[model samples]
Target: MLSGSPTQGMFSNSRIGNSESPNSGASSSFTQPIIDMSENDETELLSITWNQDYHCFAAGTNHGFRIYNCKPCRETFRRDLKVGGFKIVEMLFHCNILALVGAVANSHYPPNKVLIWDDYQSRSICEFTFRSEVRGVKLRHDRIAVVLEHKIYVYSFTDLKLLHQIETLANPRGLCCLSHHSNTFVLVCPGLNKGQVRVEHFGLNVTKLISAHDSQIACFTLTLDGLLLATASITGTLIRIFNTMDGTQLQEVRRGADRAEINSIAFSPNVQWLAASSDKGTVHVFSLRVRVSGEDSLTQPNVAQGPALFHQNSSTSLDPLISTNTGANPNSTFSFMRDMGSWDGKSAHGSETFLLRLLPKYFSSEWSFAQFRLPQSTRLIVAFGSENDVIIVGMNGSFYRCSFDIVHGGDMMQKEYVRFIT
Candidate 1:
């Protein structure tokens, strides 16, 4: 029910900006109405994750998988169990059980399959089947990998059997696992322009094959001490940062001022902080350091500056507080240049900002609501839904939950709370 693109002008009700070029920094600003369903309900949703019990969070739609419960119900203001379903389209929870996958059978069936639900005991026990069409689904503890369509399988989450497959000759489209390394995993496929990343060591062999992004490689992350490795690329909006040992590339941050196509890359489980998402919905968070001088890289930690994904020439502009005219379009400004009079694109990009409100050209803060206009081209991913919440995911699967507080700390912050159509 998610994945979109029947065209029809890309299904719009109000993503407005029908091209509004004046610099496309787009900003008519308004958001915050459509919260939990309504305006005809349609619901297609698609991906959401966060359920090791932090109050609840699980979503994936096309016909199954829904569980929202973040405290709500002041006498029926809604959301008490409003959904909870679980039709299934990929899910994972381990130890307490809840592993799903079914959802990809249309022209009379046949599409890899694997469903194993049991959130406490809601049903479903097993199905497993694979030959194609799964595309990715991690999960670590008991270990599970599932990536069908050129193989990847793995599994063992306590008896779910099948332990090794990994065959990707090509086409994988993003898969992750390595918060601290259960065995090291990472795979990507910006539609397969071919941007290697192999790590595998389960039985020991392909112990690393990162050709690292020149193209493809759309999203990646791993710095819970698994030793840095942050990739991004759907062509460019730059975001390298490798060295997961030898893949070396360490340091590069460029953000959507022009070639925006970075959709997702996160890493803030305590490794400092580094969130990124773009396809114009923006969402940057930087603050990760380790650059000991000209050529140690993995930089971006002088602190105080916030937006501005690119543009810093004259020796990074003399750094008296970093700010070399982020204007000319670092996708519509916000690099915190020494406090340009209390810069506010809403905490930096919409928590609120209005100098007469005219901020388009790729402006960021719609806060949440990864996208509703189905039919592809939204991307926007973002992760970390538990320790302080982040989850955004939206190609068509729709998802939204934001909560950040940081405030001048190592990662610097302000999102505070953004329930954009949860």
Candidate 2:
């Protein structure tokens, strides 16, 4: 996540002027310790994100969005006044148009509005008026999607322009996009009876509707490669993975009484693992397989009278759809591996619990989500945070940054870690 050494080691020798000028003073850079504001209530954070271009951290809170630049002692907090009568409730960003969905957090305000902001400038670039309060917001590629009431609206980036409008045919709750490669998307409407996810492609007429879970689809995530799709329910009980290509069911992953509701799901950059947030205030990380095996192949089940050598119970229980008989080429779909234990959700007291849990354990070298604590009792609604960059949302519309020490556990190491899922 976040990795930085003392600045003096990296930037000690520097000259400010031309070689001819012998009097040019030598310039030096020194690394300063990050100011830990958890000790003070004023610096308490609500939500934080990484501004990649700026190489610094930015956060959104009950007060306003604040930027934390690396420069020493410089002012970073900026109060947004352009979007009048709106206090930021959610901030979502993609490659373009840093979109912010805000309602009247202050009861004294009239009507609610969603503001689309430019990532770097901190200005309201586009505004959209909604009938009901916005429950969720997501931005992908050049399109911005929002959920209100039972409808999901997709719009062009900025200008608050409308693109395609779709009704969930049920209560629309959460929205997830398939990845940057395809314009396809899946919608989660928990209010509907059984957990159902609608897959729709933007341009051509191709849509797949299927029942995903026995209960509500609390959280879902698509691998960056767009190969695998994973979903978890509110019960924190069941998690399923699907193949993105043919809309086939892959694996059931896990099912049982888990202590938390699945709130957020994140895939490792390399697609080697997945991180999921639970309502019990913890995170779960699981290893992802790149290819299916002998019993997990899809060809055997559907073929007519292939060899009856393998028992039906072996391949059926893990994934009934995949077969080993037909000699069909194994599909590289991103689905869950049926048998695996969830990572432990234990927490350390006082200090940063996330820092400790996100590190590699003895048996499994991969990182996991561990429960971290806040100043007081706060019902964490949504966590758009990462190890180096995390923002936890509370029920009272309050938010705070949960900072953790960065450990070098992966290939891609960043100076500061702030993962934003839009």
Candidate 3:
């Protein structure tokens, strides 16, 4: 979900002094203000989203939007058109093309229209207008997804031809995620029923439905290859991972005992780790027991092949037995233990089932191995950076880069910090 504005008025011209924290390290402030404060213009941050590759992010503001590079933490450019503000600005990798939706504050670029902006041309080359406000827009090299309150529209990127329409449950948050892998195209969205997820595998022309949770889905995300999905429910205590192809539950990890409004969930590039952020203001990273299968495992399903079918094949599924064996190998177990830091190996489901057969399932739930605490007042989104590093972007205009110790999993070391907007 996108974060709401912290203040209503235009941005202040007065520079904010740097406040150093004992644990946050030395703050690296931007040399100049990213936004130009005109005497009459009013602006506030409406949204911030990282690009597909996590290299850069676009910040949507009431006045316009700005793009910033991720690693070095510097403003690359800004598009303060002044005509209206943008509620969402989605980038296609580092390309010049962007999918933009307008904020409610500006009628010039209303929320009902999606403007396909071309940075090279410095104008909207094409636009998609809808009956209702566009809640979100996602862009890929070959496709564009326009998310509405009750429906999602998929279009071909080449000609903007409508390809498919998916009916979903009330998706006020415009929850949608797409696979970035070139070999396959997978689109996941809310299903027709509550707590259900519809997975569209374009490569195989098949759709799989997974009942991810008993409660409504609060947040979810996919691995880069689109093979695995991580989902959190409105309860927000546990996050479940599923095999996108077969709708098999691979693993489950708990966020906490208390309920939280999960804001975002992210999978590491290698699919070995998963991270989640919520209203609790803490980012949790879990070492995954699931492994990415070979390319042959992603082959199209052969329904006529009987037991060999992808969906029916038990060997490929992460059944209880198979799931328990994950990371059980000597080398993998050692690595997993190292990554888990102080985590005892007792959390394994197989061990729990054997020793605590009469205990409640809650006692068997997997807890996060590492965590990074932030201000609880702000809603933040988390994503994996390089290796053990995690990148966080908050509604409070704060950006953080923290690294977890693979050998000690409690608190993450803050490597860098910056206030992108002030």
- Candidate 1 regions exceeding 4 Å error are 1-63, 66-145, 148-228, 231-240, 243-246, 249-273, 276-422
True lDDT of residue 255, candidate 1: 62
TM-score per prediction, in order, is 0.27, 0.54, 0.81
Q: Regarding TM-score, does 2 or 3 come out ahead? A: 3
Question: CA lDDT of 422 in candidate 2?
Answer: 19
Q: Is candidate 1 or candidate 2 better by TM-score?
A: 2
Clashing pairs in 3: none
**Predicted structure 1: lDDT:** 0.45
Candidate 3: lDDT over CA atoms? 0.74
Expressed as tens digits, the lDDT of each residue in 42-138 for candidate 1 is 5555555543322444565544445544443011122111333222334332233444553453221123444443333233344455545666566
Error of 1 at 34 (Å): 25
Using lDDT as the measure, name the better of candidate 1 and candidate 3.
Answer: 3
What stretches of model 3 exceed 4 Å from their correct place?
Answer: 1-42, 293-316, 319-351
Which candidate do you rate higher for lDDT, 1 or 2? 1
lDDT of 3 by residue, 1-422 (tens): 12222221211322322212111111123222223445456457899888887878899988888898889788888877545688999987877777888888767777987776666544444567777889889888788898999898887765555778889999998899998867668899999998999999987788999999998988889876677789999999999998787788878888899999999998887666789998998999987777654344345344223123223335543542133444432222223443444436344534433544666667666778789998545889888888799999988889999998765677899999999888
